[model samples]
Target chain A: MENQPILSVRNLTKKFGGLTAVNNVDLDIYPGEVVALLGDNGAGKSTLIKCVSGVHSPTSGRVTFQGEDVNFSNPIEARDRGIETIYQDLALANNLDVAGNIFLGREKEKSYLGGLIRSLDDKFMRDRSAEALESLHVEIPSLKAPIETLSGGQRQAVAIARAVYWDAKLMIMDEPTNNLGVPEQKKVLELINALRDRGVPVILISHNLPDVFAVADRLVVMHRGQKVTEKKISDTNSEEVVQYMVGALDDTRKAEVVG
Target chain B: MTDGATKNIKEPGKNASKTILLSLMQVWAWVFLACLVLAFIVAVPLVSGSSVSFLSVRNSQNILVAITPVLLLGLGQTFVIISGGIDLSVGWVMSFASVISALALRGAFNAGLPLPLAVLAGLAMAVVGCGMIGLFNGVIIAKLKVPPFIVTLGTSFIVRGMALLMSENTTVIGLPRGVRNYGNESMMYYVRGDGGGFYFFQKPELTVELLRRMDRIITYPVLMTALVVAVAIYALKRTKFGRYTYAIGGNEVAAVRAGVPVERHIIKLYVLSSVTAGIAGFLSMLRFTAGSAVIGDPLLLSSIAAVIIGGVSLFGGSGTVVGTVIGALIIAVLTTGLVMLNVPSFWQFIVVGAVVILAVLIDQTRDIIKNKIGSS
Candidate 1:
């Protein structure tokens, strides 16, 4: 746990005109650990992750990945640097097949006529995509069916497969298990553990408390645009975490002297 | 083990049959076209009592020639519609191209340029000039955030006025005599002259006997259109450009998030649409040996109708160039067949309009069934 942090954020803040969505936040994510980010609605959980994922630029602060400061202007830049964020919507093109979504931004091509013409290498992509899904023990009956036709859990597996195939160093998932059936939620929890075992750190933003308790090594709770408390899994229970989530507990203020 | 078993459950027999049915539905237009041709063949013999053969080579050539321009227009529309946009200015874009090409050709010929060079200049001006107009439409819609419908409609009116003003409201004529020959020349001619001679890749002199005996006509324009169609099919099905077009249409927000350059792609689609329209205009100009401001006016709606009839969704996301080809053929056959039967030409409009609605209804029903199968 004392090894160098893979990602670190210091004094990060984001403001939208008159409102402060995220304020002066400091966080660090170490390698090979699942860190759950728990917060109630409008607690800036999504905004904080969005800033780190390059969806929005922080109003002020610094984000360091692999010990180098990064200011990503778009999601692609962040993804190229080994940061994969699965948004709440999953970011899958509904009309595309599973393999197509897996290779959405970057596609494989076979060139002909000394590079004059390049055609999509769909066979290679499908084979590789199948390998990726198999490694995760995810079963999809058809890789050619459009994403819209897939069940919710299957879509989530495809998104996770994309991150794995790309060898993402850091995974940020927002409410990944939401809207999923109970069995599907268990599958996702298992997948998070698999990612951690492979030494890829994950920052999971979820409202599901039992899921956090089941898979996370540590937890951070945010309340009203501020991180109120962070605790080891053994140090805090769901009741105490809920207290921090609803703004009933404050660790930063407790450290401030009453002078 | 339960997780693996639960997810791996599949009914192979049902899924396999469903996949076959789904693919057949996707290609229903081709089936519809085959049935149409068969019906016309049967009706023509019954009505005319073997006098006018509907399946004759000459009539087939007529239908093929008639569809070239409309097919070109529909090719471009297929791309635009698949990318979730519309280009209403395509007809005027055709007119604009015709005028520009005719003017360039006449100007170059008067300047003592070689005949081939003059023709090349006409083609270059027509294609490049219309491409510029396409670029204008793209920039306004993508950069200024204008709705595609409004932007293209506005450009249609502006281009219409420009074409009328440029041509001074009359047909532009006075091209070289050879220009007319280029339009009518076929690849091979069989002449009954000299005791039945076959002229390969050359137009033999049209004596009364040769005119009466000639049955095979495979023009250069037809070959050129074939090449374009082949290339268009390859591009839409196999290339990154086609995939991106579908992705943008399917869910623009997801495409953008995936780092697809949406605005740049949109601009390219418009440019491609206009270029095809330009080609159609240039071909028609060659076919007529004259350019009229109103040449493409009636064709604008027909082009869109062809695309709709081809199974392309107006809402975007799914379509194929092959489907468009069959759709154009359907309209061409209907128009030519109606004239052969001596029905009023006005009936062509009502029939084509009705076909458009029918095609869309079938497409909608197929989609509903597909959804059901997908979910089940």
Candidate 2:
């Protein structure tokens, strides 16, 4: 999994008029490690992910995926290249069922006579969606149940399943455990670990230090639109991480090693 | 992990059962049942107080003529409403199409052209004009970001003004004989033996014309309405465009995020609505054999009201073409029944207004119930 970094961002910078939202940050996410991006609000964490996810193009710098520099015009292009983002909102249509939401834009079709008579392959979709969810350990009662009926944690699970189902190599989750209860958060953490076990690279963005400590293999701290420090989880404690996140860490703090 | 897993398994099953129960009690089910009963009740008067011989085939034929155009217009309105937009210009578009066709037949444009070509010209004019108006509405909503209500309302007045100007505020008459024959034809009949005595009577009895003049009651427009309904149902239920319409109407922001070309799909929906209006216009022209600027005035409100009353959400998404057809039938039956009951025309308007209000109230109640169950 560590043979090559699947996604590499070099000196990526984003500015909104007068403010520097993300200032010359570089990152390399490997194929299997779960990297937790930690920062307080206004710390430019979201801006960095947004740039990588193609919601916002970087103002300057290169985003190279699979060893090739690519510019995504929109999220669709990013998704097509298997860079799936699970936004905090999940973005599932509440009126549609789990399978419907999973295959929202990229719906499967059955066609005959040179695509003249087209029909939805509902049976195939239901079966495949069930297989995907079951493989992910997402215990959904019915694929036909509307998304609005699901709990927050279940919804998050469905979102992750959708991303994974599309064969996304790099999964970016933004504040996934924000409003969830303790058990729900644990479930998400378990799912993240399961993803890493399956050789999927995960980028988890969170304000919760405990969640980060529980799941992340490595930590990347941002302070005022810049990468303050990057460290392996075994080498850093919560206090040292918070210090780096808030821009209070000294040079010695950056040099400290625990591995 | 075990507790969380157990809770998750328990909740979805409960929620699914609740949803199934709620849908069973939906107001649409009741409205659908009510429409069937009303249809039966209305038919009773026509069949009662008269011998089997007293019922005329022409009366049944007249009912079909009155309902066909409205049904077509209702179909167009259903599409627009389901897409979360309204088209008020359909009536005027129909009038414009009919008047232009009638004028064209009178050598307004082509000299000695065949009737079919003239009719096609009328249809094209209606389709292009109404479609443009609809396109304009969609552009304003998509690009300019104006509300659909205001855009369509403004276009309604503009279209009516155009229709009036095109016909010179006068009725265009002298339609071609071929076009006139469509409305004049009757497609159905009832046969009865004509005799004054029983078959075994000792004395011979004089013969009477119990049934006569069987004309085709079902016209081309009526068949067209059926075709339109069938196609609409298929398109809305089976096609990607239909699914996207529901998705966008359900949640526009989510749809856009999902990479749906939101603005383009909406524009197409508007275009489809107006094209249907154009078709309805041509059919109405054929029915009346003359086109007046005032031909589609009542239709503007009636068609929209029909779709709404039939159960298409005024808020958009989650509607069926079948519901719209039922809605059109409801309006037609109500109007015809009122006339049969000798109810004043003014009273009929009052009753329709009441029904529309009731339908909307029922829809709102259903939504509230759904949200309650969903949240729980």
Candidate 3:
């Protein structure tokens, strides 16, 4: 899993007409490693992630996955390529149950008479969904309970489990623990660590320095849509990372200072 | 783990019972149940002192015939409302369908066409015409990004004006005997004895008789309503399309992110809704044997009211087809019962208005309860 980087972004830049939201960012994420992206508000972290996740096309440069330069026109295409984004909203329908939300768009069905009519096999979906949740160690009370009834942490777990069940290779989580309490945050961090142990490349976007320091193997700092600095978590301190995030350190300053 | 799983199953059962009881106590359920009771109460008085004769049967058949088309139209409205849209144009579409089919039949029958072919032509015209209007509504809403309410409201005027123009604001009658018999012919065949004894059954009294009686009681509209309900339930519960509908209704942004063809689904909903309205129109013509420009006047409010009463949320993503059917039946029973009780025609409006308000209140209460449970 650590032999090579699974996803490589080279000189990727995104501009919204007059505003350059993301500028010339290069990142390499390897399998079984956690990369934390940290920035203040409007720091282009979301824009950069959106470019990679196919929510928005990069204005310049390219995203290479498995050594192939690829462009995604939509989220579905991006998801089809084993890149899944877990947005902060979780994007789950509250009215639907766990199984229903898990298989929202891509539902499995049994066909009668050589595929003339398709029928939903509820039993199969329920069993498979239970297996998926169990694999993630998410102890959901029932598959029939609507997601709205689940705790915040459980909802986040379900969203993560859905991505894992779909065989996502590169998982991008945006502020996954922002709204969670201390214990829930601990649960999600553990889930992220578990994901890494399973050889899934995880890109964590967070503002909590302690959270990043706890789990991230590498840190990428972006300021004003540009990659200000990149550092291995072992070699860098929170003060140095904060300096890069607030534009207090430039390339020259970075060279003068050794971590 | 075993204890956890046991609690899981047991808790939902307990919650479901509570929910069912809560739903029973809902104002809509009470109103609907009360209407059924009122129907029986009125029936007793209306038939009192009159021979316990075939008159009751005939009246029941008449009520069914009148209600069938409304039921079909209401079913279509239920789908639209469940998806978080409205279709005021259904009534106009129904009128247009009937008028166009009547005109087509008059021309085709005169040209020595077979009766079945003529009937098919009438149905096709209605379906195509109403379906096109629905498609137009979908296009305006999805492509042009117009709110469904404004688009459908605008379409209602356009369709009504078109129907008026087509019919020249006049009644079109003189449909052939075959078409007339579809609604006019007695569904039941009875054997009468000279001792004032009558044996009421069906045409064959064996296979065809039961089938025929069922057909009469059921009617094509009733059967179509049932089919619509079944299809809707299956789609909403089982199909990917149904899932997407709920998803989109729940959150359009999330649905789009999940790769749902949001625009396409919304368009299809509108088109199917109109198609149902068209079928309802043809059924109305079959029952009445005439197509007037104003044949669908009573349908607009009734259909919307039925769906609302059936537990469909005005804001999409919730409700069931069964709920809508119950709603339509409630309206049908109430209207019939009131007429039997010799209630003033104007007073029926007050009754319906009160019921609609009560249904909406129940819906809001249910929503609040669901949210409270969810949040907890």
Candidate 4:
């Protein structure tokens, strides 16, 4: 029972008109584990996570989160149910401030006399958002400037902090360390390890093998929209994982191609 | 160096400079607009040899009074403009409202309803009618995903044609006195003469006539314009709807990912724009005492010009209604100033065009300067 996955997927599939972006893949994430998904470009890593995070609807599949079967129509629905996705671009409005980006749709409202006049409780949101950033060890000098001014790594940290602040039980970070410089990249890797230590499950999808090896407990590799292999970091090396991701026709995929 | 020490050495200085730069950009737009208004006020008196006393109470009241309808339309235009959209048809929509409301009130009074109630009904009908046109503009722009410029421009022509068809291109007259009074009413502080009299054109000035002249003070239309601007400021600055509007305008895809109902907010924005146009029309109809299909013809260009000149970006997402109101003043006062100084009427258009270009030029320059600073 202790080894059971916290979130389970059964034969998840997603298609865009004539093409199936993600084809019949089953994956699971357990609490206190960092599962790294490895794939080349267009290998459906993002699509599979989008389906689970409610950015896209699956064609046919079952997603069981924390032991309950659920369907999320949008990100808001997925977020409410304790699943959060931080896309590659971070999906933050550049015109708004740090607190605003964090609580864009979920603003705290002030209520009077049993919920009469409800306006944004701006002071509360500002203070709490500062607290949230502090918890994640993100040191933004000002919370009032637009998010666009922040460095790439700082932006990534804010995105991660927003998810954590919302009580996300499972974070699907797509390309979390894609374009960061060495120092920033190191900070993000440290952040992931810190998140894992706090007992939150993370599904890190990236091509950066060293970073994956540094944090991920389990590695799930996909190729041509199909799961090629799954391995524990202790059992295999990054050199072996690349063989599965490169579509070198790992024995399992070759079986499907031939049969 | 240790990793922890390296992390401790953060770039707080760069962040502090950026904060100052960002705040400056926001405040500069308004400061620049105020300077434009001030420059005009000061220059007209010096340049025109007092043909226009640019800052006199009566003259200030005149500019405010004349700009009432314009300021109203400018408020709505600010909303549309801020949301990364433009509504070109608002001018004709106003004309449509004026014609419809004028016809309704006159007909209602003729049909034996009390004059005040009939006037109220007519105003209500005008607002409702214009709001519908806005809704039509909204549906096509939001759902059909047509560009706002084309959708609103096409809708403006259709509404203009409808207003003409409603009156057969005639100017409706004999409006109810109450409706007309709304256009004409004003408040005044009577400056009682201290028994001083002067001769004018070889005749002695009578104190009774002087008191009567003093009795007429400031007009109510200025106050009305102030109220509209105030309400617009409140709506855009102090509400949830406004925040969502800015978010959508700034980055539509980001707003959607954050769960803001983008299409719905945009539709409401269009409606707000048209309803204000309708209100402006009612004001103009009262002031002019006639509602013609062509009454709104000049308003479209003036209001849009005012908005752009006020520093509201055509690209959307960064401007204030307060800036917009000042833009309206600049245009209205310039027109009045030119006419008073006996400048050719056609020259007014050229100056307005030049001012619009200048405002945009300033905006782009500010952006470039900030970018240079950012990189350095």
For model 4, residues A113-132, the per-residue Cα lDDT tens digits are 89754566677778988898
Could you give candidate 4's per-residue lDDT for residues B175-271 as a string of tens digits? 7666656666554443444753333222233567664534333455566667878877866775667778778878888788878888988999999
lDDT of each: 0.88, 0.77, 0.79, 0.81
Q: Report the poorest 10 consecutive residues by lDDT, candidate 4 chain A.
A: A115-124
Evaluated against the true structure, the overall lDDT of model 2 is 0.77
Candidate maximizing DockQ: 1
Candidate 1 docking classification:
medium
CAPRI docking class of candidate 2:
acceptable
State the DockQ of every prediction: 0.59, 0.45, 0.49, 0.42
Top-lDDT structure, candidate number: 1
Tens digit per residue, CA lDDT, model 1, B1-376 = 2353226356678777667877877887888788878888888877877877787777998899899888998999999999899989899989888888889998999999988898889899988999999999999988898999999999999989998998999999998878876666777776543656677875666767667877547676777788999988999888888889889888888888777889999999999999999988888888899877888878989989999999999999888998899899999999988887778999999999999999998888778877877667
Candidate 2 clash figure, as a count: 6
Better of 2 and 4 by lDDT: 4
Order candidates by lDDT, high to low: 1, 4, 3, 2
Q: Rank the candidates by TM-score, best first.
A: 1, 3, 4, 2
Extract clashing residue pairs from model 1. Answer: none
Chain A TM-scores, per candidate, are 0.96, 0.94, 0.95, 0.91
Error of 3 at B137 (Å): 1.0
Off by over 4 Å in 2: A250-259, B1-24, B27-64, B104-110, B184-215
In model 4, which regions exceed 4 Å deviation? A16-18, A111-118, A249-259, B1-52, B189-208, B215-218
Better of 3 and 4 by lDDT: 4
Model 2: what TM-score for its first chain?
A: 0.94
